[model samples]
Target chain A: MIDWSIIAEALPAFAEGLKTTMMLLAISCGAGLVLSVPLAVARVSPHRAVWGPVWLFTYVMRGTPLLVQLFMVYHGLAQFEAVRESFAWPALRSPWFCAWLVFTLNTTAYTTEIFAGALRATPSGELEAARSLGMSEATIYRRILLPSALRRALPQYGNEVVMMMHATAIASTVTLVEITRVARDVYYNHFAPLESFGVVAVIYFVLTFGMAGLFKLVERRALRHLRPTASGVA
Target chain B: MLHGYLPAILGGLQSTLAVAATSLAIACVFGILGAAAKLSASRAARTVAGVYTTIIRGVPDLVLMLLIFYGGQIAINRLADAAGWGYVDINPFIAGTATLGFIFGAFLTETFRGAILAIPRGQMEAGQAFGLSRGQVMRRITLPQMVRHAIPGFTNSWLVMLKASALVSIIGLDDMVHRASLASAATRQPFTFYAAVALIYLALTTISILGLRWVEARYSLGVRKVEFK
Candidate 1:
């Protein structure tokens, strides 16, 4: 019942779509990881003046749908003459820029929360010991707290990365020829849902599990110390 | 100014809520069955449930939705043809809800299974010891206690599902997101309408969090909190 001809014809387009999807996933996740570290630090800050705005930003971003956020950046911003006439308008006009911006900010919001939760769960004794060692707060975070928290955050962070990969499908709505968009185009042209969407679904399923397996390897390396020693009781 | 489009947006909000609520109910049904299957003695049932959740979780929701929408329509029509009935058109509402229900059901299955496992085995044993049937023990003891453990996961799923209802617009359902798009196009104030829709979503989520907290508290009435000094 599957149409091999349609799948063969769509191969090049699907290849292009795969590149776009991967680019979206890689760029957003890379940038989001960098941005979220500081925001997460701020999120767990003791002072309201420090963490309050960060909390609000993450809250609003998390509370709304990423699609709405995408539209707000892509379509909504273009509605304003001031924004359109501004120096940033050229970049704003590109769907790539808008998708990158929205996906980065959206993933950053979630990653910040995940990291903050890990930070919050840090044991009190660790902090006390760092203090007793005459380490500065900055030094403590850099040397002790962050390393531990980030290791603990790895599994959840891996899940977030997979989630962000799935989220790139939303880029299709903004005219980006990602995998989902390619499938949609194929569906429209060939009237073949099984060949079009089915192929894309299988591709996604493979990519998802492949990435999950990769994360498991990273966790094994990073979390090795937490595992019981070879000579220890089973 | 909403330019008299506020009412239209509000009307669409009703549809959005309807989709989320109906989908949640359907998901709960699937979730319970899946959880039971996973927890059952039968290896075939466990494997089926395992594959169901793994496949559902691995794929993107939008991909699955479109697959269900277009793919499902074709399937239904072919069945109709075999029965000598005319072409069958699937309603966007039905397709959207079914797809959302199917997708979120996987997540909820995990949630419900964990919740069931959280209950002590002794509770079920004692209920069985009292001469109650397994079904009666499950209904009277396990399900009630499971609610407390399930609330947090359920809330997370619901919020995610609520936001996901926005995707139904892509399939041609006139949800709030679709209405906002219309209003934005007509008014040429895209930011205003989209931002308004976002705020409405925030309000709904905030309200849900508060309401579910109350439900959770109610369920935890007889439970005592552990304190560490």
Candidate 2:
């Protein structure tokens, strides 16, 4: 029932699509990670001024659909005369830049919440010990809080990564030739759903499980301390 | 400002809600069956449910929708050709809801399974001692309590499903997103129209959260919390 020749012909396209997908995933995730740490720290701040705006930002972001966010950045911004005349308009015009900007912000909003939750869940005793040691606020945060919270956030953050990866498929709507876009093209050309979407489904399956397994390994190492001992005490 | 298309965009909310509500119902049906299968005595049922959840969860929703939409159309037409029937056009509404329901069903299966498992096994045995039938035990003893445990996960799935309904526009369903695009194209105010739609979505999300919280509280009325000092 399946046609091998069509998939064979589409292999080259899928490879290029895979490259685009990986690039989008790597850039957005790396940028999101860097941006989310400080945002998360600010998110947990005692001062309303520090945390309030961050709360609003994450709430708005998490509330709306990512596709709408993408449209606002991409098709929405171009409608402005000022944005068109601005120097940054050139960067804004590229689909790559728009995708990167949206995906990073989207993932950052989610990661910030995850990391902030993890930071909130940090053991009080750990903080007390750090403070009693005369550690500076910055030092305590840098050395103790961030490390433990990040280790705790690893699994959730891993889910965000996989989610963002899957989300890159939406980049196709804006004309980015990611895996989903490639699959769509293949489908339009051959009218073979089994050969086109079926193949892409397998590719995404591998990507999803690959990400899950990678996170499992990371959690094993990072959470080794929490693992049960030989006597069954955690 | 929605540039005189406010009503048009707002009207699309009907379609959006319809899609979300229909898909949610379908998802619940699939979810219960999947949960039952997983908890069944037969190993084959468990394996089938396992594969269903695994494959469905692993794929992207958009890909699945497109697959079932276009792929299903072709498959049905082929069957029709064999039966000497005419062409069948699959409605985007039907296709979108089916795909969303199918995809989210996998997630809810896990949620439902976990919720059911959270109940004490002794309760079931106690019901047996009381001479309640297995189905009676399920209905009277297990399901009601499961609702409390299931609420948090159900709320999450609903929120995700609500947002996911926006994707139906991609398959040509005239959801709010699609209406925004049309308005944007007409008025040349893409930002304003999309922002309006975004705000509407945010409102829906906030309202859903509050509503679900009330539901959760209602369900948990019988449960007592133990606090650790």
lDDT of 2 at B18: 97
Off by over 4 Å in 2: B226-229
The residue-level lDDT of candidate 2 at A91 comes to 96
TM-score of chain B of each: 0.97, 0.96
Off by over 4 Å in 1: A230-234
Model 2, range B146-218, lDDT digits (tens) per residue? 9989989998898889998999999999999999999988989899988898999999999999998998899
The TM-score between candidate 2 and the true structure equals 0.98
TM-score for each of the candidates: 0.98, 0.98
**For residues B33-133, what per-residue lDDT tens digits would candidate 1 score against the true structure?**
99999999999999999999999988999999999999999999999999999999999999999999989999999999999999999999999999999
Q: For all candidates, state DockQ relative to the true structure.
A: 0.91, 0.85
Give the best candidate by DockQ.
1
Best by lDDT: 1
Candidate 2 colliding pairs: none
lDDT, candidate 1, equals 0.96
Candidate 1 C-alpha error for residue B36, in Å: 0.6
Lowest summed-lDDT stretch of 10 residues in model 2 chain B? B1-10
